[model samples]
Target: LESILANLSAGVLVFDRRFVLRTVNEGALTILADDFSGLLGEAPENWPRQLALGEAIRGAFAEHESSEWQEQIELEHTDGLPQILLLRGTQLPAGSHGGYVVVFDDVTRLIAAQRSAAWGEVARRLAHEIKNPLTPIQLSAERLQMKLADRVSGSDAEMLSRSTQTIIRQVEAMKRMVNDFSDYARLPAPELTAVDLNALISEVLGLYETSRATIALKLAAKLPPVCGDATQLRQIIHNLLRNAEDAQESVDSPSIEIRTRLADNLAEMIVTDHGPGFPPEIMARVLEPYVTTKARGTGLGLAIVKKIVDEHQGRIRINNRQPAGGGVVSIALPLASLPTRGHRVSQLPTEA
Candidate 1:
């Protein structure tokens, strides 16, 4: 019985009707980062203050009948970040000795994933609504200018031309923005194939050879292939390169470094650049759609990259490099040799 309770996935704790700790499983000790000996026979109010479970437990005992409640608790011991836990408390049946049982599970990652999916649905609906009218508006402006140019003369004709040009340009800009939203919202399943990472990176970089920025490549030899879609991978490379270029606009000398290597069971690709790093304020929410610092940016580039990476069952991290000044974007993908299912899977359209 003890061994079984020790291995349970969820943390379990039982307290007496008076709010004294009756029993705690090994799972609870591990989840709460506390010792079993310290919790036994102690009142909930006297439990370790750091755990912060005192108030919730006491309230449950105060109730006249069985009740249920849920809350999230953050623990600094796990890491420097908040770890979200889904806690459910149930009042045990009334009897000669009544108690309460509490169960909790770590659900931080699950909540984040759900939020991302919600954003993608929103992007798809927004694109559908905004993109439909842009083409007609642009064409109408073009036709109005061409047909009426000879009909009007002098300042009137000049004014008409400028107005139409502004309209066309603005409409074209809107089209680009809507297209980006569509891409983020409606990404198709990746067509999985064994792709040589080094070769793919070299090919993508070749497209920017004539640019003024200084670019460097450090391709590791004998690197393993990864399973992913070549087209989507190319887009990811392009977006990262373009972002690096834009980030360096305020700097005197711009340089970008693309590197590939094998790490443990994963194939890694890293893009680093000497430029103004991501602003501290938006760093946490960088992958969120429509969150941007650039004056003209649609802010969907990184979000789209994240969507594609998720489709491939890969991971990505972005952070400012230490000591030296710059930013790093690193991606880790499972090697092709690993046993994995094809990435081709459908996502049902989420309603707006």
Candidate 2:
């Protein structure tokens, strides 16, 4: 029984009727990513809030009639991504030594997969529905402009031209938008190769030497190469840099920082901007398609970045920098030929 508990992926915790933790299996310790020394005799209330079972344990004890209860909770990690845990709590029989048993497993990937699928379907439908008529609309506007050019005179001719130009321009913009949707819906699988991430960032930075925002780089001297598609990786750098530039539009002394380092056998890149951080309400869903805080944003930039990262088996995290203010985006990719350790399969949830 002990060996089985030790090997199980689901976390298991046994608490006495008094709410003091009694027995915790190895699976529990691994899932919580915490040490057992502090958890053995601690009550739910005394457990670290980020790792605590919270109301699930207490609610199970209170609902005596029900044999089992289930809940989903989000655990916030100050230095890492938030974890979504699905927990099931069962009340011990009255005849047995009374207590509650809680079993939980990380379900963050499952939830993310569901969201990705839903959004992909939405993108496909939007592209198919909106893209079909864009060319006809643009061509019709151009035809009207040419046909009316000889008939109208003076200011009337100018008005006709302006109206037709406006129609053409707006139609072109819509076509681009629809193309973005199509790209997101059917992004190609990346062709894997060894990529020098730092070199790629440097190359992308060359295009921004005259950018309004001052860009700085702090690349590691001995960072290892990562396995990724060079072209897609370049797109990721471009998207992040553009985001940082847009974020600095309102700042008097706009500055952006890009840093790269090696950690946990992964090549990690961090991009920071000195702009107002993500709004509180939309931070959680910021990575979702068509969700944006920018007035002119298509909101597909980050979504595509996420899709590419997911394909490369990497992780991305977004957060607001505290005390100093601004926003930070971090991407971590596995080192070439090195398996990622202590990393989950999904992107980290945004932190605010």
lDDT of each model, Cα atoms only?
A: 0.79, 0.83
lDDT of 2 by residue, 227-312 (tens): 78889989999988898888888899999999999998789999999998777667766777888877889998999999999998
Candidate 1, which ten residues in sequence have the lowest lDDT sum? 343-352
Q: Quick one: best lDDT, which candidate?
A: 2
Spell out the clash pairs found in candidate 1: none
Q: Candidate 1 local accuracy as lDDT?
A: 0.79
Q: How does each model score on TM-score? A: 0.73, 0.78
lDDT of 1 by residue, 1-352 (tens): 6777778988887777876788788777776666756668888767664445666556644653567877776454433234567777888777757778888887767876887989988888888999888889988999999999999999999999999999999988888877888888888888888889889999988889886679999988999788778899998899888889998998888999999999976789999999877776777568777888999888888988888888888898887776576878988886777534355222211210
Model 2 Cα RMSD, 1 decimal? 6.3
TM-score of 2: 0.78
- Among these predictions, the greatest TM-score belongs to 2
Positional deviation of residue 15's Cα in model 1 after best superposition, in angstroms: 5.5
After superposition on all C-alphas, the RMSD of every candidate to the true structure, in Å, is 6.3, 6.3
